[model samples]
Target: MIQQGDAIPSVAVKLVNKSGVIDGDSATIFGDGRVILFTVPGAFTPTCHNNHLPGYVSAGEALRTKGVNRIICMTVNDHHVVSAWADASEALGVVEFIADGNATLTKALGLDKDMSGGGMGTRAIRSALVIKDGIVEAVFTEDQPGQVTSSGAPAIVEFLESMPS
Candidate 1:
C-alpha cells in the first residue's frame, strides 16, 4: 500500500461530478491545497453507503476547517449511480462523488482488484489518502478484503489533526 510522502501516481481519468464529466488530473485535483480522497469497493453497498460516505459527510465541516480543500468519495461505479447515491444521502452539498467506471484511476493507483465473488467485479480497495500540494501526506488502507482498517473518514480526520500544522 502507498504511504506518507509517496508521490501519488501522476495519472488522469474521466470522472463525473455534479457539474458533469471532467478530465481531471489525479495530482492537480488534489494539489494546491489539502485534499482527502477516499475509495470504496462499490457504490450503495451496505458499509459504503451507511457508514463510509455518511461519516465523511458528517465530518465535512471539521475537515474543511482543518485546511482540507476537498473531500472526494470515489467508487468503481458509473455516473448515474454515483449521482443518485449522492442525492439520496443529501451528500451533494458536502462531498464530491466521483465515478471510476473503468477503474482508470484505480488501476493507475495500483489499487485495482477482482471482486467477482462479491459480484463487484474489479474495484479499488477501501482506502483513504491525505494529499497536500499533490504529495501524499498520509494513507490508510484495509489490510485485505472484508476489513475496514484505519481508512474511515473519522480516522483520517484524526490523522490530519495529529499532523504538525
Candidate 2:
C-alpha cells in the first residue's frame, strides 16, 4: 500500500466536471499543490452517496482554508457515472470527480478491494490521501468497507489542524 512520502503513480484518469470529461493523469492532478484525494468503492453506493461524499462537499471551503488546492473524489467507475454522481450530489463546483475506469490508479496505489462477492467487482477501498507536490504526506484508510471513520472529511480536517504550519 502507498504510504507517506511515496510519490503518486502516473496513471491515466478522466476528470469529470460541468463542462465535460477531460483526459488527464494522476501526476498532473496531484503533483502541483496540496490535494485531498478520497476514493469510494463505487458511485451512488449508499454510504458513499449519503455520508462519505457529503462530508467533503460540506467541508470544501474549510479544506481550502487549510491550504488544500483541490479536493478530488475518485471512484472506480466510468466518467459518465462519476459525472452523474457529481451532479446528483451537488458537488460539481465543490469537489472534482475522477474516473478510474479501469482501476489503474486504484491498483497502483495498492488500495484495490475485491467486491466480487457483492457483485460489485473490483473496486477501491475507502481511503483518503493528503498529497503535496505529488508526494503523500498522510494516508487515512477505513478499517471496514462501509465505515468512513478515518477517511472522512472531519478526520482530515482534524489531521490538518494538527499539522505544524
TM-score of each: 0.90, 0.98
Q: What TM-score does candidate 2 get on C-alpha atoms?
A: 0.98
Q: What is the C-alpha lDDT of each candidate?
A: 0.81, 0.94
Shift of residue 64 alpha carbon in model 2, Å:
0.6
lDDT of 1 by residue, 93-125 (tens): 678867888888788777778988878799988
lDDT of 2 by residue, 14-86 (tens): 9987677999989988999999999999999999999999999999999999999999999999998998898
lDDT winner: 2
Question: Distance (Å) between predicted and true CA of 164, model 2?
Answer: 0.6
